[model samples]
Target: MSLDLDYLKLKIELFLLRKKAKKTFPEDLSNLTLWSQSTGLKVAVIDNDGFNLKTNLESIGVSVTVFYDYFKPVSQRQEKRKPYPFSQYDIILCDINDVASGNDGFGELQGVGAIEALRYNFPFKMIIAYTGNPAALSRRIKKEKSSNLVDKIYDKQWAPEDFMETFKESSKSFSNPEARWQFIRNRLTYLDAKEKEIDKIREAFVYSCLLKGNPKFLLRADAELENLTQSTLKFLQQGSMSDALRSGLSGLGLISDVFGIVAAIKGT
Candidate 1:
């Protein structure tokens, strides 16, 4: 009997391809709830003209509060120049150009000053620094170590998409139980027989990866995989190999080439 090595190779390649194509899930309320049980995040946006963007974000389930005139002079004091009570939000999104024009103490405000204020006043919150002036954003990232205070930076036109994408990526990392497992499975697919032994070594590496990064999702994934393995073994021990394989593959959404042969042999 000839082994279908070509079919196995294709199956492995496809698995690797799927792994590489896996997108980080967008962060949203569901993900936040999975981790923190928070209903909705409070966000404050400081901009001269992000009314539309704020509206869009609000439509998507964020509790958005806009402090619209970050460009008005401090001396103006005409409702627009008042300092925002920064304590109220989970995240702050600031327009760099607006910061420069608004705060006289910063004197033609730089992104660094905006970042510093957010960092000092709102140490627990995330900051997104956006600017229509690309030069200012770029200068902030390049010349100022203070830019680290901001979690992300984007141009005004792209801020909405970029912000959403950040949430998606974070959400995926937080909520997907199989992310690291899928990562390992993909790496396994590329190995030659000589490297197949590496799978034994991978458990430690995988555990290390989980430990070094976010602990919450890592623990959740580990618990999920453990339960899955236990259930699979129970099915196998009952001489229900076909049921075991089907359940395992279906649970993983995996289609191995050997599955066809197994199914054919089992008359299923």
Candidate 2:
């Protein structure tokens, strides 16, 4: 499907709003699990240090299986100790820091190898690479075409809280895909318009600050300019910025003056 700017804008706005609202975390996964009955979510966690995660997953009512380094080997002894049949779970949560200990150790199994194994062994399941090494995980995902294997990649620092937030948002959005799409479209449109207005405000502010010739004002204006540039770049990277805006306003049937204004601000 084509990218919908309005939809993208809405998603971002809602995300920001949610952050501001500070939604309470469900005591456990009780509400989430009940919600999942209609959604049919079966979660599994794999971590060398799984004690806390295991408890949290269980509290949410997900049937969780933990796989530590010592337990990863396929040796007869390790095979005997495998907790849950690999085929039992719908989702797998793997830790990147896990290191096998026995003669049949799986080594570090950090980057692409572990993801490959999970995909090769269980074609039906989804894997969430929960790691402390987010930079490495991101790099691996970028280099490989294993997006199909990984449903999500989360760093350990943000796993519990961020994952929960993402799950809740996805669950809510997926409930009615059509409505969600429309909502997103509208939001993107609003964001595009808002961005233009903000750009104009920024240009005027910069001119005033520079004209006043106040060092303190100039410094503040410079900081504001940096922030605006960064924000614009972020939207462009995410494909949330409007094509019309990127192509220049004249092409989008906007007043050429708006384009000139934006360009002037950018130049400064």
Q: Judged by lDDT, which candidate is best? A: 1
User: Model 2 segments beyond 4 Å from truth?
Assistant: 1-40, 70-84, 99-111, 169-268
In terms of TM-score, the best-performing candidate is: 1
Root-mean-square deviation of candidate 1? 17.9
lDDT (10s digit) by residue, model 1, range 1-268: 1358865664465344334323322111122212221225567788766556766666656688877654334654465544557665656778765554545665544545766666654433457776667676666567765444566666666667775776555323222334323433432332221232333223323322322233333423343334433443344335423332333233221221111111111110
In candidate 2, which residue pairs get closer than 3 Å at backbone N, Cα or C atoms, i.e. clash?
A: 5-188, 6-184, 6-185, 6-188, 6-189, 7-184, 7-185, 29-60
TM-score (C-alpha, index-matched) for candidate 1? 0.44
Residue lDDT tens for model 2, 64-173: 55666424456564365433355555566777665333324434544345555665555334466777887876765677754454656776777677766654454332
The weakest ten consecutive residues by lDDT in model 2 span: 252-261
TM-score of each: 0.44, 0.42
The alpha-carbon deviation from the true structure for residue 64 of candidate 2, after best TM-score superposition, in angstroms, is 1.8
